[model samples]
Target: MALEDVSLHIEPEDIYGIIGMSGAGKSTLIRCINLLEKPVAGEILIDGNCIFRKFGKFFENNNEPELMLQGAELRNLRRQIGMIFQSHNLLMQKTVSQNIAFPMEIAGAPKHEIDKRVSELLEVVNLADKVANYPSQLSGGQRQRVSIARAMANMPKILLCDEPTSALDSLTTNQILDLLWDLNQDYKVTIVMITHEIELVKRICNKVAVIDRTRVVDQGEIGQVLLNPSMEITKQLLSGSRGTRG
Candidate 1:
């Protein structure tokens, strides 16, 4: 999906929500922030540093993209931005501890440091007992918790979550949301969550953006957008979200 003129300004330590129905381009917008998907004409700036800029409409055109960071530099920058997906995406063959240590190993961190950080993250996610367990042995929620621990292995300043709890039950979803809230408050990691569940946004997010048909129809503080939705699409979404937890 092509996102048109989609712009968002997320403040530090904010649990920002990007809400929309299926096929609304919400995933694309979030992926663009990490440059997993690049835009053709606009520039992406992280902490006021230009990541990518292009003037042309078509990315396949002859024009050169202004890549401020490429190769090793871009990889280093990605270290500061961690991504979580709907699927656990854990290595089926690796134990929880090994999975959590994967990112640090790729970055060439010292063995002792990786072990120490993995232990700390396991404790943070309240999965110290599951450190030796494989993804198949854990339940749905536990696997998600392990994934969360792995995403935090690098201590990223920003965490991009794409439907992190969409696969969990209601109780488990709330538990995950609470864990995320705690992480934001304790570690000050900015969270940008992509969800179709409006109630989930109200439960955890302070600010939100509503995407409809590949555009941001409404955005602001959670209270403002819910109380005074200016667009019809926003109102429809709100109405549809009632009684739906996931």
Candidate 2:
């Protein structure tokens, strides 16, 4: 029960950021959206579908069972949504190409198609030359780029990033943010990023939600909150946020 009464909307083609302190249920909220962390109540609707809403006795038919997605149905839905972690969860033993192609391979894509898509994704993430390289051979930033490519391998409608750039330095973080922006523009993928850095939000996010103590204290267009913060936590976060974004 990390989150309580937390709600937010993310539009298509959005790079939405969820900003908060370390223990503010930021990860829990994002995980709930993907069904990683299930909430006891509340409906999480994506594309107007309530993924978490229970059925059975709660549905219109009293005798019918819960209309929950399971097996292939759930897998198919998950395929349409991609998620990346704070750590580069690459296959250490597999080459970069193989890691990027892992999901497509699992979904039974053809060898030729996997190869072709891997090549295209590598190019997109600017890692074409490192196709044969393993995760151990790449730098932190390069590994993150490869993870991003893998996340997009399925051409998902939504991409969930959990502290995508927290491990990198300021320069590399900026680079990764720029890459995310490029992906959002090119693929029209809706992005939901979880982060503790407000500067990161100002740099990339269009809409944002600030969470604290399992609750969302403030949220709206990034411009509004950044320019004029209202809540005490929001003001504190903004005050500590470094740099002056243009």
Candidate 3:
């Protein structure tokens, strides 16, 4: 794979959006942040720690032994970051509450604590009554809501959304965006979303980045970048409006 240079700083409480075409490398950029795709060059910093550059070598071997992490440090880092995907990735056999509670269970939260957290999450996503319903019973939008609840189960400081609204209809997309905005306001969680939706960027994103050919072409405040797009590719994307809308 060819190397691409990209850089951006997302502050806490900011809704950062990355827009691009299907092969524009949006997915690769997000994966690089979590060290899921190791970049041959460049640095990825999370909360001031250079996690990628510092630990890049650790991922060299797919079968590398898992090193014991100091309990508090590992817990703190993992609990502070959350991720949600377009697929909803819910357990078909599990109930809504159970799916939302899965992460907390993995982290070894007490039973009472898990229950309370799940209740709060369901309320946040407006799925309080569907707690007992399974994924098979919920609509695409509802399923995405459940995924959001699960992602936020640990009250993460940073939330990564990879084409989160791609499978939903317009109405549901708006609802989900509103929910995310609400979360940003209520919890001050920094949201980094990867999508091909120009409308979505105009609607909720305060900061926007345009990626093309495995590199970021332009990025800035939404209003400024949209008004005076610095890159030709960005102007083309905006003009054609061929990107993903949902």
Best lDDT goes to which candidate?
1
User: Clash totals for all models, in order?
Assistant: 0, 0, 0
Overall lDDT per candidate, in order of appearance: 0.89, 0.87, 0.84
Model 3 TM-score relative to the real fold: 0.88
lDDT of 3 by residue, 1-246 (tens): 343657798887899999988878788787666555666645566877755442245345454333332457655666667888989999999999999998899888999999999999999999999989999999999999999999999888988999999888899999999999999999999999998878888889999999988778899999999999999878877886653332
Which residue pairs show backbone clashes in model 1? none
C-alpha displacement of 239 in model 1, angstroms? 1.6
For residues 1-246, write the lDDT of model 1, one tens digit per residue: 998877799998999999988888989999888888877677788888888887665545546556656788788878889888899899999999999999899989999999999999999999999888899999999999888888888999999999999899999999899989998998999999999988899899999999989899899999999899999877877887744434
Those runs of model 1 whose alpha carbons end farther than 4 Å from true positions after fitting are: 57-65, 242-246
TM-score of each: 0.93, 0.92, 0.88
Best by TM-score: 1
**How high is the lDDT of residue 171 in model 2?**
98
Candidate 3 steric clashes: 0
Write model 2 residue lDDT over 34-60, tens digit each, in one string. Answer: 777776655668899767665332334
For model 3, the superposed segments whose C-alpha errors exceed 4 Å read 1-3, 54-76, 243-246
